[model samples]
Target chain A: MTDHAPKDIDTLIELLAKLPGLGPRSARRAVLHMIRKRSILLTPLADQMQRVAETARECLNCGNVGTADVCDICANEARGNGILCVVEDVADLWAMERAAVFKGRYHVLGGTLSALDAVGPEELRIPQLVDRVTSENVTEVILALNATIDGQTTAHYIADQLEGRVTLTSLAQGVPIGGELDYLDEGTITAALNARRQI
Target chain B: MTDHAPKDIDTLIELLAKLPGLGPRSARRAVLHMIRKRSILLTPLADQMQRVAETARECLNCGNVGTADVCDICANEARGNGILCVVEDVADLWAMERAAVFKGRYHVLGGTLSALDAVGPEELRIPQLVDRVTSENVTEVILALNATIDGQTTAHYIADQLEGRVTLTSLAQGVPIGGELDYLDEGTITAALNARRQI
Candidate 1:
């Protein structure tokens, strides 16, 4: 609520301010930049934002986000059969996708199980995953959860629930400690995917 | 468009894909992250985005973007005086503000006068600037143009137009060749501000 003309610039800054790493100050700076580059940056950015605001959606089955209901991986016929790579979130799913290895399908866990946060299987998409294993003819489940305690705990819980029903594996070591799939390079993600071992 | 469930993820991805530094792929990843962090990140981000999209605007006088029409800087009675710092764009104005050295007022030219691009005085709000100089009681004019050929040419033109009417000066010579003022650190900007010499 500034005492100004309040037009294009304010709309842009307000949008930018909601970004993960941006505050009011940074948002202000970013808005100014976009405005200055209106032809090359601002106009297109505005158009895209409007378009996306009207289009983006989540995959109901896999939790992967897309401009569709089921998402590409889930809908693709070429993806590996009955082998779902379980990920903590979509970033991990994207990391796996970027590798272009492991043509298998994916399952997004939404988040790790957290006792401190009182998270449980029901809180995540675990129940749906269990249903997918049986209904989709899934033969293997790769636990591509993050290496944090909560992530591990969630993985173990899922494994225990689905034990003996499907082959269980996890991404192999080489992922740096405290590493997030979002921060990993394509090559590293590929290597990790290729070398994935049974848990 | 993917072939999956709920269909909302599509809307989210389409919106996210439009963000800066994001493509369709990255947008999917980002949307997934937000969905996963729904309670923690997504809800708040969505709320903020919606709110901002509804309320942001620009300053009528200085062209500064804000939540209001006049903008905080222009509307402030404390900021008014006959000293106007003319900048090639809003980014330059922001950099000057970040340096926190100037206290008078600002005049955003929108862009420099570019001959190759066929940009002229009318396209850049130059006439409005001339109007402000006389109407606002401005004594000093700081030409904070970028260190580019077009920028310098525009600066010269403005200085020529205002010759004998006000004290005209340009930012000092430490600005790197072809470097954007936005890329420079706070210290460099501060030093540049401190060392600004007469044109």
Candidate 2:
């Protein structure tokens, strides 16, 4: 509480600076904006954050976030019909969901296998994905990972592990090279999904 | 629910699909990811959302977001230097703060004076800004508004109103065309701030 740091603003700036692609400068701007839109964006966002902090949990079965364990998707009996789409991250999964296509379960890998980061299959949920394939009677596995080198590598590894156990497909070529699923438009994603090919 | 949404997965999918940039395919994928990352990303994200939902609020004075009525910045006696930096949005203000350059105070003008949206000064905090400038002994008014036509227009209007009463300046070059200050790098922002010329 010295003259150097304003406590609350400092805490907020630190938190904001940790967000992906945000530096100190951007964090400050974001904080200021949230302050201005407090009634609209800031308040709502904070409320959502608090609610999420309190009640949100990861589905024990899948990696999706929800208000409860096993998540709504994993709890749903209708979605257990053997189709599982695997993604690199939650944002990617969310992107796929935005398309309003695909009627299947999901498995989030948390992140792709990065050689630079020393992320192997074990670091990811690859082992869990393999176990789920056998337990869920899955007929198809859609490798909907991103198009990055790491994403492709992770997808290939998953495909290898599930070889011959079930049908495997990946999203078609509408996704640009090095592009993340999170950045793609719904129409592009939809087109890619509709034209998916067997890997 | 019927076969159309016989499972919580479907319900979850419907909800997730409605998120920004997410579609049905991505929603299902995201839901799955959250389920798997229950203890990590999903749980934390949900909890954060909940927390933010409950505790977030606007700063009564500067329109910054915080748990209290007056944001941390607004309530701080040290930040009250009678020098108000006006910005189009909180994001811009946050950017300035991130640079840790300015120590005065802030006035977030929710948005620019947009003729297309029929937004006027009354619709924004322009009047509040003017009041703060006069009452706060503001030696200088930095118009850190965006580079957009509307942003510049708003800056010009404020400048004209203040006229000879205060030293007026705008963020200098290095800010890309139509670029929001929030998106600029810290060094670039610093350079721009250092090079700022009179408006």
Candidate 3:
């Protein structure tokens, strides 16, 4: 800052810069743009941010964020019929929801099992997930964790915990949609080939 | 959004998405990050934004944004002792101040001359700049606009208007600091060679 910059504007820039994918330069640009559009963007954005700060909370059962004590997904009985999608984070849960492919409820583990980080079954929402499976009468649980090593380890851990108790499945590994074979990695290509099926 | 997203959170995301260098995906991630860090970041940021929205205003003299009617650079009598740096926008003026090389005042033009956009001298702070040259005993004016076509055109227009009244200068065109010849374009290399001095 020039020291001539108002303290409030400078502070806003610093906090905004802390956000993911934004650095100091982009944050300054964002602040300038906000100052220029005070009514349409800045004031309303401030109001909304304050409102979210006051009300946003993690779902009691699934760890998903929402305004209520229980997230909409967990509260809706229609969504909790049978299948339960298990994910590594709320971000993954939102992504699955965005695709609109999954009709069942979700369980966010918060994080994966990591020995270095001292994260274990008790650290995540695993116990809550198990309770939900039995208490909510879930018939099938899909391990939709990421393809990372830690993610797979967590998936296996959950599978062991729920084995024989209910039907369990994992998302199929294959070439992604719109992916070109020429640009595909060897592991993905191999997986796609190994899991090839009749159309 | 899955419609499960709280209205305030979604509204905040939408407003944030309108900012430069952010899109829908990044905005979603930023909102999630903000919600996670509510006390330290989200609440404080909201407060600061509201403060800026209520207090920040453009300095009537130079078009520089500050919390007062006249910006610090314009109000300080010590900074008015001759040289004036003319910038295309408030961002450029702030950049100049951050460098701390200039010990004079600044005049923000608001924007450069644009034919298609029908922007003329009156649309910017050009008239006020000319008035300051005479009223404030300015001896020199530095056109610190960007190296864009409109910027240069605006610089030349201002130079013609203030010719013979005060010394007019433009930033030198050449390789930028830390720039390498191997990575430089031909035009910059040519400009550097043309402006080469005996070392």
Best by lDDT: 3
Residue lDDT tens for model 3, A1-199: 4344777788888888999989988999898999999999899888888999999999988889998899888888889779999998777887898789899999988889999999989989898889989999999999999998999999999999999999999999998999999999899999999999999
Q: What's the DockQ for every one of the candidates?
A: 0.18, 0.15, 0.71
Model 3, residue B160: C-alpha shift (Å): 1.5
Taken in order, the candidates have interface RMSDs of 6.5, 7.2, 1.6
DockQ computed for model 1 against the true two-chain complex using alpha carbons: 0.18
Off by over 4 Å in 3: A1-4, B1-4
Report the candidate with higher TM-score, 2 versus 3.
3
**Per-candidate TM-score against the hidden true structure:** 0.63, 0.55, 0.97
Residue-wise C-alpha lDDT for candidate 1, range B37-139, written one tens digit per residue: 5555555444444444445555678766567777778877888866888887666776787677888899888888887889999888888888888888889
TM-score of 1: 0.63
Residue pairs clashing in model 3 are: none
Lowest-scoring 10 consecutive residues by lDDT in candidate 2 chain B? Answer: B1-10
Best by TM-score: 3
Between candidates 1 and 3, name the one with more favorable TM-score.
3
> Residue A82, candidate 3: how far off, in angstroms?
1.3
Following a full C-alpha superposition, what root-mean-square deviation does model 3 have from the true structure? Answer: 1.4
- Quote the chain B TM-score of every prediction: 0.75, 0.77, 0.96
